[model samples]
Target: MLKNIKTESFYDLCIEESLFLEENVEESLKYLYEHGYRTIAINQSINDDNLGAQKKSKGSNKKVKNSEVPPPIDLSPLIETVDKLNLRGFQIFNRLTITYSNSETFNKFIKSNHYKKYHLIAIIPTTPEAHNYACSSAVEADIYSYNPENKFTARLTRKMYNKIVQHGYYFELQYSHAIEDSTKRKNLIHVSHMYHSTGKSKNVFFSSGAKNLNLIRNPYDILSLGFLFGLNELQCKSCVQHTPQQVIIHSVGRRHGKALFFVENVEETQENDHNDLSNCEPQKKKIKMIVDADVET
Candidate 1:
């Protein structure tokens, strides 16, 4: 249901002040881990955590002349915390929408000392018009629009995808419908869901785009989404195990403070393994245990 189905789970979109708040941090990671997500592509200007300082800065200013004045906010701390999370990866946009200061600002930011260890997850602009300035050298470029009905997201996706396919450049459609519509834009890997709230988004956990980006209970979510997509028992089981090995590999990388093991078993394979494990010898100090975890560990 959720496996290799949706294109993208662009979860990290929020105001800078709201992004790195303690509660949001715990919620985001917990959601990722619980849903078996291994990949996270942090977006620019979203998921920011500088609300407190922004408020203080605003309070300090009594008179405001320019209506176009930017919000008063300090983004240093949010940047620091994101750097420390050891996240799978995050995106970098050269020119953010509010300022739209041209690609030069974005180019400098990408090379600046501030974003050294953090890899570029994606480069998304507010609309398709902005994609021109977003370079092909950036990891990937996302053309964003809030309205699901917008034609810019759809049309530019096709044009950019065609131009960049040979270069391995891909598009991540934001606020778009199930991308099953665009067969030609196969490189556009991920798709965002229409669901806005948590409960409405229960189906997102099971979607498959990139492995690490999935929400954990995602396997179960996939099972349900599978039903919607008309899959069967064997197909569903295969779906569950589609990337089991990959998940295990990433879990190990996190050094999650737990010993990890990988066991592959089919009906016949399990029977053979069971017999071999059962027949293993037990020493005086080490008791042979049939429980897989006890013995395997």
Candidate 2:
């Protein structure tokens, strides 16, 4: 039998952090769970300059440390609300999205140990050098995302897209921006076409990136909107389902080592144990069996 498996059909990995800070955020989460979303990631975005400023404010001349990194937002209240509502299997994750233009700052910040506090790490590169670093060297990150509302200075080439996918990183496209404004919608579509033409839409997933409850779209609506971004039906479904699942699995593997196991045919194992008992003598001392240490989260 499979153990510790989650088979949810929908995932939204980019709910903006601002929404969580709002007073009615609990209501927003309830709406998402009711609309078929089982997994959600609260995203907090930070830039290289901001990190530098924070470090300087602390009067630190040495290399940046984990203390300089922003701590994950408190979700205890949200968790309590979930418990009160008894929403089973509703998972929430903390995600960090780093926007970087300087390679040096990005490298130092990416290596900080505090990154382990987040369930997923994403990077947005604004320069050609930083873009190359993200595509080739940012192995610790799970997703590569950019702001669709603003024009990006770095161009995405087919080679860069392939390299990113080959490195096991998923591309995130935010659809809420498309629904919020015409200018953003135009820019999002343009970027989506870039992904289509350059990468054939491989390893691409759609996220809400919604700052408010009204900005969030239903999963089915997102599937329909996928076609406008040059994705076929299967690709659209994978964006909300399979691809996002893979991204979660990838993030888990990145945080914990890539070790997994499953127990199959439980009835057969029980039967074998029963049969072995008939031939074996009872021991006076208990047998201590030590298995390898479980993977730490």
Candidate 3:
């Protein structure tokens, strides 16, 4: 849908080493960016542990002890790779799972790169502490990908969602299952099945994952995500604009030059249309102070 509409750029979060292995890092990122990919998110995956364990374990009786725990993951490797991403810049950094007790260690890895400037979007489980952490941290986050089948999960998830937004963080929610006739092509809205099944409210507050968005056949489906969040046509157009003009006007004291330009245009047109007709002729410029004041003798 985005391709058909010729959407200029996309923010790709959670890119993997597999992508780099399958295609060379420089080539892959360049190709994607040249073809309208804008941002890349370097995130550690939840399945990394499984993959690493499988790679290390070959013998049947091989067992790892708790005392000999693996060292903390250092993200310096990914940060180095980022330096070579010439075309696709990273807008956000993310950690795939915050479920581990040592997620703070991972957070430390990201914070270590103080020189880097980007939004950190870590995953947060549906827990009170997790919710509080996301709200308090300068880093923003989204709900962790998990089953929301039970009432407890839903309630906690909802609380986390509210907390993230209240703290001025944007979040994304994914559906565990598909809904029938839920996504309409005309408007391209993805209604939440969980919300519908649980008799909860359904709207554009939820966003389907990038994988789901790619499968959509309608152009509107891609754009409706923004529209659902109350973006009108002009605002939407401005969002897509190549270079948007920004203006800062002081409400109390300073006159806005841009506003005055239009105001002057209107006044000039109005004066031309309705002339002062007491003289029944074109008005002359009266130098108010000079002409009205007689020389005192």
- Return the top candidate by lDDT: 2
Tell me model 2's lDDT, rounded to 2 decimals: 0.79
Q: After superposition, how far is residue 237 of candidate 2 from its true place, in Å?
A: 0.7
Candidate 1, residue 265: CA error in Å? 32
lDDT of 3 at 102: 32
- Give the winner by TM-score: 1 or 3: 3
* Model 2 per-residue lDDT at 189: 91
Model 3 over residues 260-288: C-alpha lDDT tens digits?
21111112445554666644787564321
Candidate 1 vs candidate 2, TM-score winner: 2
Off by over 4 Å in 3: 1-9, 47-96, 100-121, 126-152, 156-160, 174-221, 224-297
Task: Write the residue-wise lDDT of candidate 2 on 68-131 in tens digits.
Answer: 4588877778878888888877878889998888778776766676777888888888888888
Tell me the lDDT of model 1 at 37: 50
Report the Cα lDDT for candidate 1.
Answer: 0.34
Model 2 stretches astray by more than 4 angstroms: 1-7, 51-59, 62-67, 257-297
What are the Cα lDDT values of the candidates?
Answer: 0.34, 0.79, 0.34
Ranking by TM-score: 2, 3, 1
Sequence-dependent TM-score of model 2: 0.81
Candidate 2 root-mean-square deviation in Å: 6.6
